[model samples]
Target: MQAESVGIVAGMALVLKFGRGDAARCRFAISPLQETMSALLVLKDPGRHGWYLPWLRDVEPVVAGLDLGLLGLAVPSNGHGPDFLWPSPTSPLTRIEDDLAQVRATDPAVVAAELAEQARRLDRHTVPGDLYRALTGDPVAARETLVAQQRTAWRALVEPLWDRMRGLLDADITTRARQLADGGLEGLFADLHRRATWKNDELHLTGFRDGTVDLRGRGLILVPTAFGWPNLGIGPTDNTSATSPALVYPMLGTARLWEPATQSPAIVRLLGSGRASVLTETFIPSTTRSLAQRVDLAPATVSEHLAVLRAAGLVTAKRRGREVLYGQTPLSAALLNLDRF
Candidate 1:
């Protein structure tokens, strides 16, 4: 659970908007875990066991910055589950302590060797180890090795690295980062320097591959959540080195777009309402209607509408139970009331 906070740090460091920490935080912050959270929310109802990881990613920052006494009301919550619920699993602080305890017991050198092996394993695209070793080897290698190394190296190396990297930012690195973060990340690429080429369904980033990444064909790439364009193009590394245990691959892509179909029109209308669209006809912060509720519209008809809306950036659907709910696109709120006109 705590290992997931690595994402919090990484998200805060890379994505610009998750900085001030709000809905924008979910947009830029919790995106990588979108599928994971959606799948869990689908497989079981929200607040179920399978959802621990994604929910933690979603709520941690808000909670960390929140005062415990007023946590309930401080959360600007609406809807059924996620926005209002906190899981009763171990507290994040407890999980952090447990993880640290296990880390303290292991030899740092051994963990480092294991991490190197894991990196090599990724390049080979296979876990090359005996069954016994595979079963018993470090599930914690990526966590204990790289993140720990980063923390250890931070005091001595962060300043030097920051100096080199910020030559492009034009001001002191930390100051610039805080400023850029607060400015909501729009200015991040204004005076950017580097060659990032778009090619063959992927982007190639150059000029910033310092020692932050090893020579294992692994570096970070940032892609847009709204532009269908690759932004910070960095590493998409598989952090684990064990047998393929249900792996998740996250794609950094664009916002759902709008099309000119029946489904598309309906979805665009709901999304124009400025709330989340759970299904084709549902409008959050106001109304939720099933396809059947929409007169002769068939269930499949509504599902079809949802698909179009999803493509057009008009709505978003996250899995829940046997049903899928749709919500409106926040981007096109102004046009919502015009549906009546």
Candidate 2:
């Protein structure tokens, strides 16, 4: 799926008007496929997605030989790809396989129409002649080819790092859920994005195609994306469609997602280098084994350091099954000057 861009008008906003029952229906969702699709945008313009430079560098060799022509065409530079590639996820835990299946099952007619629309929207020079012909010649075959490419791309680019990415996305959902609990919709939308403002039971999203979407009680789905930083995306730009509208916004702390935790010199001086390294690795929750792998220490040694840190009130541990996950405490965050967002 390509990153779809709406026409931007200065000070213009897309207003989503909600009816009485919409608030009860609003919900949050996590889509692995959505992240995978958004990651493609990062690859296309690495300069704009500097937060993912580390990840892009790591995956460079893995994706070098992959046949990504169709994928590249799908995510044109203009950012108007077919919406069918991103079917509204049915649940919060929607899997990549499920999302791919939905894409495969898309009607060939819809596929053809969307592809034609995309070709019309994009520069003629950008769409290769042969590829466009093949896609237009047999829409069914084109869809299959696209699905196969998507699977290959997912395996090469996303599967290995999905665990860490999912953790960040899940953490964002937890934070958003708490905001909803503590301050209701107002507080939740208050800081969702600089351009998003909630007023009069309407969500005003600036810099998007000027339009008003009436949510006749169907509500909205808020999707938190790890790859979609510095921009907001709305789904089914056509307001007449029955599908529940969705807003894909960048999650907090994405800047730290691919960053290696650096041991603070002050903490190293205070707690010794080894213990300081262990504590820094807990900036994101990690098991002793993972922490050891990250810090290049033996698991037993990392476990010992974790024990000391826990005793010192600098780290906290929670058991998930047999493995205990260690995380930095607020005290440690203050000492390191790390923002928890």
TM-scores of all models?
A: 0.23, 0.83
Cα lDDT of candidate 1 equals: 0.30
Of the candidates shown, which would achieve the greatest lDDT relative to the real structure?
2
**How many clashes (backbone N, Cα, C below 3 Å) per candidate?**
28, 0
Name the lDDT value of residue 287 in candidate 2: 75
Top model by TM-score, which number?
A: 2
- Summarize candidate 1's per-residue lDDT along 72-176 as a digit string, tens digits: 211111211221011111111122233234344545454445444434433233433442243235544433342343233222222222211111111122233
Model 2: per-residue lDDT, tens digit, 40-70? 7778878876668889989999778888777
CA lDDT, every model vs. true structure: 0.30, 0.79
**Candidate 1: RMSD to truth:** 19.4
Worst 10 residues of 2 by lDDT: 1-10
